[model samples]
Target: MGQDETVSNTALEPAVPQAEASRRRLTIEVVIVLGLSLGQSAVYSILRIIERMTRNVPLSQQTSTLNQSATPDRPWLDLTYQLVNIIFPLFAVLLVLYLLQLTHPRPWRMIGFDLRRPGFDAWFGLVIAAAIGVPGLGLYLGARALGFNTQVQAAALADNWWTVPVLILAAAENAILEEVIMIGYLYTRLRQLSWRWPMIILGSALIRGSYHLYQGFGGFVGNLIMGAVFGLVYLRWKRVAPLVVAHTLLDVVSFVGYTLVAPHVSWL
Candidate 1:
């Protein structure tokens, strides 16, 4: 019995160092990701926000330009640039996933990527999108009315077979990158660092809002509210897939709807 006990203790010992190494690897990966990829945006956003504040420029007068030509001088270059715009965020998502897999052998599953729950996620996403969409549109209009936000042009692409598809893909990429990296990876890493749930949520939400500062104070405020609500929803449901869907839905409406109606509607 003593010999058997000795054997069991010896067998268990290897796992201790293995677990410690795993943890160390994760910490390193987290640091690298924050500096290089998705997490880097918030830092830049914060600096820009400071600059905007200092400038005291009228946000109502300023145009928050997006979807500018990738290469105005050369159509070939522009096409390539356009493609790369969508690819960039997708690559960031992939990079962090690779980093996550270093420690989390099943990172996707850990972050609520459940293939089995597709129907549920879709239903939940539509519900959340509906909940967010009406108020979100109202928020934008109200902000613009109050001279707080710039009148945003959702789609600037010229007509082509690929234009709508490219816009749709861009929206999807935004959803994936923001939801996966911001909520899934950031929150999980923070939680592992022994942060409390509220702090983690707030931190994540603030970062989300921060990166949208280019849209002016209204953007900061609206997205800040969105961040908090989305963060809480992610915490409660633990399904990133739904958040992604909802986000995509929101952007699609914004981009496509704006393109179609901006010409006919004077207020927009």
Candidate 2:
């Protein structure tokens, strides 16, 4: 080969190993971050499903409750616990944002978490919510009827003055944590490591499903589909803001709506 070509090849030699090392490092980072957050929840959720399956009663006869009061008898202590539960998990979201900020000057805006286009985000969020929520409710009912799912109680907190507010905060927390980490952070990291769109979407969906397994098969299936849809939406718009908004809306409706309506509806 010519001298110039030989030198060019030698100059590029270090890049290959460097790139591979970077990929390895990113892989490890992804594992650790996930382990410290939703990945941990996914493990417990799997165990929860196993425990439910081994019970004497059918899955549909069992219950999976969220937002339960830590101290049901003491309103003040329960409120404290509720706030703690909603606030603490969000540290993971901050951690991911910090990590992203190291590489991105405007990490929040990069992931579509900012309010640059509030109207667009809101419009799309409502559309996505309607698209997912209605069918999701039907899916839940069908799954329960078919004995593939446990009865899911989205809220079990006492009817204190703070109940609705706390539920709203919890819903927002869920949206921020899940969409930020699962789609915004996870998808970005995977794409950086040269993952294909399909693989990234599927992996995120599976993890989402795994974490929701505590609610039973129906929860898993419902969330898996939700994850895929959200992943695609993120891919399409390069934004997670709408996803956060939609998820918050869905959970708010589930938690607060259930707390208000479940008492009057026998089937709920």
Candidate 3:
């Protein structure tokens, strides 16, 4: 055959997806991927918390301050800071998307995200949110009261023109970053490694729990439950939109609503 004919045949050959392109062990990939992401927080916080527990320190002594938006005197600067904070996590999302694109021709679809089912996703997400959010609130309150977890300052920002909007955006950013990374990306990657569903779900849930270690033992348990439930939901429905929506709703209420309700709710 002529050179051009040979080149044409080569080009026509089917592409080998990254999922099937390797026979490497899943354990190695797990370490590498997580080590680069939430693993840092998990490792550090776990060790720190362990040390604290050994010393018999109070849970309140180890607290995580969240959603503390600054109130700058200058409007333009405040707006700029707020916008940057809200949009920063999109970079992480984009990075995940880029990595997936290397392996998946249609990365979004492979991630089980369906834009066409916005209403369906939203409603289902609301259901999931309600299911998790109510119990989660009780868990937090009880954890705080019992001193298993730290007192979570959900909203530390004084109300400003951009405070509420920033908090909303931050919530959305977290929902997207976490759900996409944990449920969608981890699921796809684990499947590529030929892991079973139960193992994969547990691994995902554990990582999710670990990331919240800084919040204390209760944070780990609470997020662990959330992660497992979310993993199960994805396994059943193969839909990610609902998880994102549910997470967004939960954070929004937790961050914004806490400020308004903390006064009336003595326990909070």
What shift in Å separates residue 245 of candidate 2 from its native position after superposition? 0.6
lDDT (tens digit, per residue) of candidate 1 on 148-253? 6776777887666666777788788888988888888888887776779889888877777777776766777777787778888988988789989999998888
Q: Against the hidden reference, what TM-scores do the models get? A: 0.84, 0.93, 0.83
lDDT of 3 by residue, 11-73 (tens): 778987765556454446656656766666578878867776766668766657787655556
Supply the TM-score for candidate 2: 0.93
Instruction: Estimate the TM-score for candidate 1.
Output: 0.84
Full candidate order by lDDT, most accurate first: 2, 3, 1
Cα lDDT tens digits, model 2, 173-218, are: 9999999999999998999999999999999999999999999899
Q: Is candidate 1 or candidate 2 better by TM-score?
A: 2
Provide the overall lDDT of each model, using Cα atoms, as 2-decimal numbers: 0.78, 0.94, 0.80
TM-score of 3: 0.83
110, model 2: CA deviation in Å? 1.1
